[model samples]
Target: LYAGVGSLSNIGDQGMEAEEGRAAIWRLDLETEQAGIFASGLRNAVGMAWEPSTGTLWTVVNERDGLGDETPPDYLTSVREGGFYGWPYCYWGQTVDDRVPQDPALVARAITPDYALGGHTASLGLCWMPAGTLPGFPDGMVIGQHGSWNRSTLSGYRVIFVPFAGGKPSGPPRDILSGFLSDDEKTAYGRPVGVAIGADGKSLLVADDVGDIIWRVTAA
Candidate 1:
């Protein structure tokens, strides 16, 4: 049940603390409202999912702006509670522009993400397929890279799959869905924002925000 935020408050500075962005994993045994920080420093996370076999939580994070077209890469990562990802200071486990004073010690202490989905990919919507379902999709983490608008050339207008083994993601991403954009890439018919497994058990459901359509992918 961890959640990510661009900002907790609109004040711009007061709500930027990393601890302010987390939420409880679950509500258990209490009538009172109870929540706590799970992880922090995510600019915006539109996608989250748990690996059904191992119960590991992963998230797709949309990084911050103001960096040039390629400075910071949007990422998909395993979200561990109490983890701190650098925001407004560092990125991708590297110290960024010196304008922001990042403690060298703190930067070294932060956990770098698992995969860099290319700069400005604007990753979103993640899900894991159950084992023994999809024959080739064994690891089962599918992510929607929501493409980019800030870059001169747009990128990431497809859905990708990350295979996992023993609860850990391994190997390069596989393009599960693509070709939603025009041949020239100037226009796109779909901008996939979310992904989920279909009720039929063999299909994958994708939410395309740009076309306002939902696409169903099944074995051919």
Candidate 2:
């Protein structure tokens, strides 16, 4: 079993010391009942999914805030065994985070994410989209971007689709559902968080945390 660990602090760079191991992904052995660190340095690795064609483990990460609306981009990437993702010390492949105490060693090992989901989007939910799951859509990952709180203009209040090829993202993201925010962008109609394929094998399920509703999407 794989479990996610979010960072203790959003922007202060606290509680991420080597010994704390607070920001990481952990694996649990069901038989032996032993748990061990699988990957390290993910600020908030929220949604985990396995690629249908290649079987690679992937996740949508929620990066640290307070870098304005677009300093560092949140991302989606494959999880490597014992890999490091560079949380407090660095971000987005060796771009040093000046706010934190520097760790040259871990910074050298930071693996850049595969796709940038834009900064301050608060992307959280991810689910693998299999081939033929939707008639017009290709195999990909369906992501629920829960939207931003600290940004001035706001972003990511809807669900998006990122196409995948050979178990990796290949194209720009497409909007599966949008218009969650009001015309003036001051009010939120809903905030989508969790996403999954329905039991019927064709529909998609979306969980709106703000509206407290489950939305179903079917081919028209």
The candidate that achieves the highest TM-score relative to the unseen native structure: 2
Evaluate residue 174 in candidate 1 and report its C-alpha lDDT on the 0 to 100 scale.
87
Expressed as tens digits, the lDDT of each residue in 11-37 for candidate 1 is 223434543543222222345556666
Total clashing pairs in model 2: 0
Candidate 1 Cα outliers beyond 4 Å, as residue runs: 8-32, 103-105
Candidate 1: lDDT of 151?
Answer: 84
Q: What Cα-based lDDT does every candidate model obtain?
A: 0.73, 0.89
Q: Per-prediction TM-score, please?
A: 0.85, 0.96
Looking at candidate 2, the ten consecutive residues that score lowest on lDDT are: 11-20
Best by lDDT: 2
| Cα lDDT of model 2 by residue, 54-158, tens digit | 778999998888787887988999999999999888899899988887889989999999999998898889998787888789999999999988887889999
Inter-residue clash pairs, candidate 1: 139-164
Measured with C-alpha atoms, the lDDT of residue 155 in candidate 1 is 84
Task: Indicate the worst ten consecutive residues by lDDT in candidate 1.
Answer: 21-30
